[model samples]
Each structure stands twice: as C-alpha cells, then as structure tokens.
Target: MALGVWSPSLIDVVLFVIAAVVVWKLERRRRRGWATGRLPPGSEGLPVVGETLQLIAAYKSENPEPFIDERVRRHGRLFTTHVFGERTVFSADPEFNRMVLGAEDRTVEGSYPSSLSTLLGTHSLVVMKGARHKRMHSLTLARLTSPTAIREAKLLLHIDRLVRRTLDSWASSSLVLLLDEAKKITFELTVKQLVSYDQRKWIESLRREYLLLINGFFSIPFPSFLSFTTYGRALKARRKVEEALKEVIRKRKLEKATTRFDVDVNESQNNKKKKDMLEELLEGEAEGMTDEAVVDFLLSLLVAGYETTSTIMTLAVKFLTDHPRALAQLREEQEGIRKKKKDEEAALDWDEYKSMPFTQCVINETLRVVNIIGGVFRRAKTELHFKGYTIPMGCKVFLSFRAVHLDNEYFDDARTFDPWRWQKNAAAQQVGGPTVYTPFGGGSRLCPGYELARVVISVFLHYLVTRFNWEEAEKDRLVFFPTTRTLKSYPINVRRREEEEGA
Candidate 1:
C-alpha cells in the first residue's frame, strides 16, 4: 500500500513470484483444454501423435477399430492426443454426441459435407450454416418430395425390372457380385428419378463429376502431386456440369425474361412450373453466387445422396452375409410380402416403413458398426466451456466411433452384430442414441436425405430379399476397400435364385 519508494519484505517478493507462476499455468490450461481430444479410453500412446498412424494402418485390412478399442479400454472414455499441433476428441459417448449435435451446436464453428466443398464452391450446401442451411434444405426437399407420388409408382416397377434384368443375366456366372450390381442399379435409378428431364448422356456426365469431386476430399491436398487425378479431373468434370446446367438456366432465364412466347421453342415443366430446388437455388441470393455455383450444388447432392447410400448398401450385404440367421430372417419376412396379391402386393407406405421395428434396428446396428469413413468432423464456433475446461474457437472436433460402438460398456458383446440389443424390452445395452449412433450425424443440420436413405435402402432390401435368392461367393475373404483417394467400398459375390430354380 505504500508509495513507489517503499521497500517490501522478503516474504512479499516470494509471494509475488508464486502468484505469477500460478497465473501462467492457469492460462496454459485454458489453451490446452479448448482442443478436441484425440485419445479415447484405454490405449497406450505417446504425446502429439497418439494413435493416428495406427488408425491408418488398420484401414489396410480387416478390423480397423481394434487399435481404437485397445486405447478406449485402457484409457477410459475421455483422453487426449495431439495431432498437427492441435488436440482433438475421438468419442463414442451418446452424451458427448448429443452435446455436439442436438444442442444447437453453437459450440462448433461449422460443418460441411467436406468432400463437396473443394469441388463445389465453399458457399455450396455442404458449407452452409443457419439461414442458408434451412433455406437450401427446404428447397431441396420440395424438389425431391414433389415427385414422390411419381417416385413411388416408379419404385415398384423400377425395382422389379431391375432385379429381373440382373437375375436373368446371373446364369452366365453362378456367382453374382451384389455390391457392384446394387450400386449400378441405385445410380441408374437415382439419376432417373432425380434428373427427371435431363438427357441421359448429360446426366451421366454430371454423375461422373460427382464421383470425381468426392475423391478430392480425401486427397492429401497436395495439388502438385495429384493435379491430374484430383485437381485436373475435378475441374474438367466441373466444367462439363457447368456447361449443361448453364445452358438450361440461360434458356429458362430468357423464357422468363421475355413475355412474348417463342413459338419455336419447346418449354419444360420446370420452366412453366415454379422453380425446383436447383432452379430456386440458382435464383436465390445464396450469397450472390452464379450459375456455376448451382451446378456445384447438384453435383454435390448426387455424390452425398447417391454414394453414401451405395456404401451403406454394401455394408448391409456384408453384415447380412456375416450373420446367416439374420439374413434368413430378413428373407423370410420378405417372402411373406412376396406372397401378397397383385392388388395388395406388399408395399411400405410411410406408416409401414416407420413401423418396421426390425428394419429400423438393422439400420441403427449397421450404422453403429460400419466403418464407411474413418472420421466425423466439426469445427469449434466459439470458445466452449465444459468440465471446467475451455476450448478455443475455430478448432476442429472429431469423433471416431470405430472403437466406441465396440466399447464393451456401450455393447455387451460389442464385436458381434446384434440388432436385438436395440429391441424394446431387451435386458438393455448402452444405446448410442442419435449422437453416438450418428452415421447421418446429429443436430437439426444433420443430413436431410437420411430419411430418404432409409426409405430407399428398406425398399431396395425388401426387393432384393423377396424377389431374388443369392449367396456370398468368398464371404469371408472380401473386405472394405480403402483408398487414400476416397470413400470406402467393398466387393462381394452372389448366386441368383431364378437361375438355380431353372436348373
């Protein structure tokens, strides 16, 4: 309390030094706490790098989550690891998932479909937040939902015709690869239903671009190395889509711009009717973007909407083959539907689809187990405080549930695939719920097409099971193919029933 000239006792100087040290340590803790945790419970790892290398190594063959399992079991649910000069959380906890997704996610900075952002503009749907997300999703639902009546009619006939065509050809080879066949069928149908009026060749070109753009995401971001495969290919494919979309958009603009009818020009329903999502997005402010931006959105949707579904289908079959009893049960259920009269031919109306408890369990179980991608991501939006720890904003957050679902606490015999664990009245397993079971992710901003995926997947499975008989060729040998290049895919073989019956 004395003036500047006054001297302090030796004890006062010692107290000042201790106070300074304490303050420094507290600041350091705040900085450290803001980053996401990389190490999940149980496992041994050195600082900074943790188990990243092990994860990539696991992707080389069967059972990638084991390393993750080792860590989670040893460490417990929450632990830390540093990577690329940052800390991250890799969680499988339902509560943690709920915090990230369902809780308005203001803790997270932003999310995107990731792979789509590099190919499309950053402002595209994958990168949108708040108002933009709501608007775009609404518009997209309108477009996708508009033709539901038409799509439903298309589904029954399209499914039957597709199965028969594929099965009819199955005799050439006793074994059929359901993986490839299902993708092609879905791709063709997705294009037909979604593209609606585009010319076949043009739609094909767009589809090709979508696949290319997707690959760009997983690449090392090394432009010099992959200019030809990733960078150059994305640009060329993007240009093709831009050309086709721009032409249509321009024609529509001219038609709308001029009141007088051009007698020679044939008009599209899209032009006469109110704008579809694509058209609406093209016209909407969408942050003052241009025609190329709109094309990017369409291409991205096809990639996420189509490709993810295809991956799920592949995993579903692989799971079904692994558990024959479950597979048999599914087919038996389908057989009952197959016996229905033509007028009552078992179709899943919205109610029936939602009511399929067993099928819902199958989907959740599949999502819980499938390692379609190695990571889930979000960036911190603001400095968030949890458990007396502060995480600085703009840091990335990830939950690699590969190990969590297999965590014994979450599942009793976690390695085994069991849909019954989720069934009502079961003794009880730790449910991952929406967050930890998040293949579609959590939050209001969760993937809009998830419901659409369930419908498409359920219908596809129903058709495949009831109408065709098939078996795995190298059931055990096949594994999910991992490329440093892109999304996970698998190859499996099957035998067609119709041909066996004919024999």
Candidate 2:
C-alpha cells in the first residue's frame, strides 16, 4: 500500500509498533548512558522500585551486611544501584566516604529520603544547605559544646541528678526494659536542656508523639491527604509536637517580657537558672530564624540527643554485659573515681567525667559494632571524580559507614565487640584513619552533640556500675532495619548493690 493514501494491514501495524518500541528503548538507554557517564558497577534491579525492596528486606533481618557484602564481592568497594527512587552510588571505601562527607556544599549536599525530608521539616539541619547550614551548625555546635553548657556545674549536676533519679526508680523493679528506660532518661535530659521543661506527664506525652514522627521517617511517603499511612500518621504527630513546642516558646517569650516589668522574688530566683538552648535561640543568637525554623531545629536536636544517644547507651550496656571482663575493668576505673570524691553521693565534676578513659573505649566500641546510624545520604551537585570513576551530577550517594565500620580490612575482626582494641594511641587510626570509624558521622555534618553524648553515657555508666548489678532477663536479638535496635528493648533483671551487700 502507498503510505500517503493507503490502509495498513494488521501485520504492518504490528511491525510499526515494534519498531517504535525499539527506537524508544534505544533512545532511553543512550540518554541514560550519556547522563550518567561511567557509573560504578551494580544493578538497578526492577524499574522505578529498583533494589529498594531488597535493601529493606536485608535491613529487616539480623544481618544487613549481606546486601552490601554481596555487592562488594561482585562490584568491589564502590558500586552503583538504584534505591529510594533514585540512582545512587554506594561507597564503602574509607577515602571515598571521607571525600564525600568533606565535599558537602562543594560537590555534594546533604540529602535524605523523601519521607525523612518531609518528616524532619524543610528547616531541619539535615535539609539545610550553603551559608544557612554553616551558620546554624556552627551555632548549635558552639552552644552544645561550650563550657557553660555540658561542662557547666549546674548542667553537670542536673545530668547526674537525672541519671541517679532514673536509676533509683529502677531499684524497686526487678525487671527493666533498658532501652525504654534509657530513652526516658535521655528524653528528659534533652527536654530539660532544650526548653527547661521537665514535667513528667508532659514529657511522656511528647515522647509518644515523637516516636510516631520518628517511625514515619523511613516509611513510604504517600500523600498524607490521600491515605492513613505510617508517613501520614507521622505527619500528624509532627504537628502535635510542633504545636507543643510552639506553646512552650510562646510562654518562654511571655516570661521574658514579663520579667522586664514585674518580677516576684521567686520568679527572680527561678530566672537565675542557666539558660537553655531554647532561651538562646529566642534571645537572638539564632537571629532571623522563624518560629517554624526554631521548632524544626529543636526537633532535629531531640532526635540527635534523645533517640541516637539512648540507643548508644543501651548498646554500650549490652556490649559490656556480653563481655564481663570489659565491664569489670570499666567498673574498676569508675570506682577509682568514686573513691576520690569527698562525698560518695555528690555529683561527678567535669574533671571526673573527663577522667574515664576505659569508659570512652566502651562507647567507641559500641558505636563501631552497632552503628546505630548505619549510613548517611548525600546528593551530588556536580560531576564528582573519585578513583578514576565519574559520579554523575544529581546522583544520590550513600556513604556506608556500616560497611566501612564492619569491614575486616579496616579493623581486626571488625565485627567483634572488643573494647580493648581502642586502647592504642590514635585508637581510630589503629586499623585505618579517623574516617573509617565515624559512628556519629564526620566532617562539617558531624554530630554537634558528640561530646554531650559521651558525657551523658559516661555519667550513666559510672552510676550503673557503682550502684547496681544487672543481668539479661531474657534473650534478645538486634534488628537493623529502619534503625538498629534490640528485639526486646533489652530486658534485664536488676539488683541494687546495697541490697546485695546487706544480704
């Protein structure tokens, strides 16, 4: 038939459709090849979904390393895969991970999954960029690390009192869920440090909402208006938390204003207490930051200071329990400190807190082995060349701290819980460089509360070893998906040291 004025046969129509499909596929492949240039070697798995399902499944299991280990065997340390709805390169190489973290805002920028970005809010530090990130990060770091903050006498006393009170409550109970209890201790401390609000009922209510918000971070992001999904529930919980925080901010502002005109004697005495982070943010250190921004920032800090730090503390206890020799050594060190104090009931001073060397080893080992924060996500801003391979612009990169931390090449029996390994000078460098052991992340994005975490954990350990004895009440296993945590919240049977001595 003449193409300009003829009817086509069914076979001819079929042939034409086939040809078009072929052309379209070829064009798509050609565009992808050109856009990505030379990517690392790995599979993109199923279309659209990619290997995300596989990643999630592996994470859900007790061991998540197989996902990366299998890939590393086939594709070496650096490989490519599609996950979280984007083509990404997974880097287990220490040098590459270091470069990626250090290159923030230059060649790459901090990124997270759509769910995380939405739940954490647009103004959260993890989603900030350029000068705004630098300013907020610097301000947060300074305030948290300052002598007037963690190291202050009042704050140190507060932390010690809080830790002691928490442990005291546990003395009456024979069985305790360590992870849940640890969360309570850290949550109250964080709330106190942030807003100076420690009403037990209010904090318990806020924490319930916070947990819902956190669970949504790793969920499939469906439109909240469309369905009642985990992410949707998370969005709702976030609103409740934000409203609670905003009310706190409003009262704080009103108090600040009222104090200027009329001050009762008790009010003046109360005002003499040291300023919290919220007070600093409200009084102009974070000038021009909106109420929403302030709330988001505090929300992020709560995640950092509360969830992660509590997990670390719980795991540290777990690790030490699994290795009694380490626990004994740690107890001896802490006891030595206790002997020097004039009053055994007195709070630990800054020097005493800093003096626990072996305790630091336990914390480091826990961080390395458990890797509560398995990895971080960043987006490439420009073509990034590393080790003769080109990372195309706009590609998501995952710096697998878990892979690096668990790799035998980096540490001797890297997966083992050996606190003694950190005994050498330049402990992190004993096996590899500092980049290889980034439990709290690294570079400019390093956790601002790192010191505070160490201090809090150290304080808890001192009281725990010196005051009480505990044993696992039941067997529990670790789960790595969404986040790393114990299956049973690490239940333990406790006995106060005094009762044991009296018996």
Best by TM-score: 2
> Candidate 1 — number of clashing residue pairs?
23
lDDT tens digits, residue span 139-197, model 1? 66555532363254444355445545654575576565565566665666665543344
Candidate 2: misplaced stretches above 4 Å?
1-36, 146-148, 263-274, 425-434, 485-487
TM-score of each: 0.74, 0.90
RMSD of 1: 11.8
Which digits, one per residue and each the tens of the lDDT, describe model 2 over residues 1-503? 37645554565578767865776566457447646477888998876567999999998887878999999999999999978767789989989998888888999998888889888888887888899888888877777655556665377888899999999898678999999999999999989888999899999999999999999988977668734788889999999999999999989889878975565555565556447789878776557878888999899888888888888899899888989999999999999999999999989999998899899889888888888778889988998898779987778899998898899988889889998888973443432235478887887888777778888899999999999899999988887878764454999999988889999
The worst-scoring run of ten residues by lDDT in candidate 1 lies at 480-489
For each candidate, the alpha-carbon lDDT, in order, equals 0.57, 0.85
**Candidate 2 local lDDT, residue 186:** 92
What is the TM-score (0 to 1) of candidate 2?
Answer: 0.90
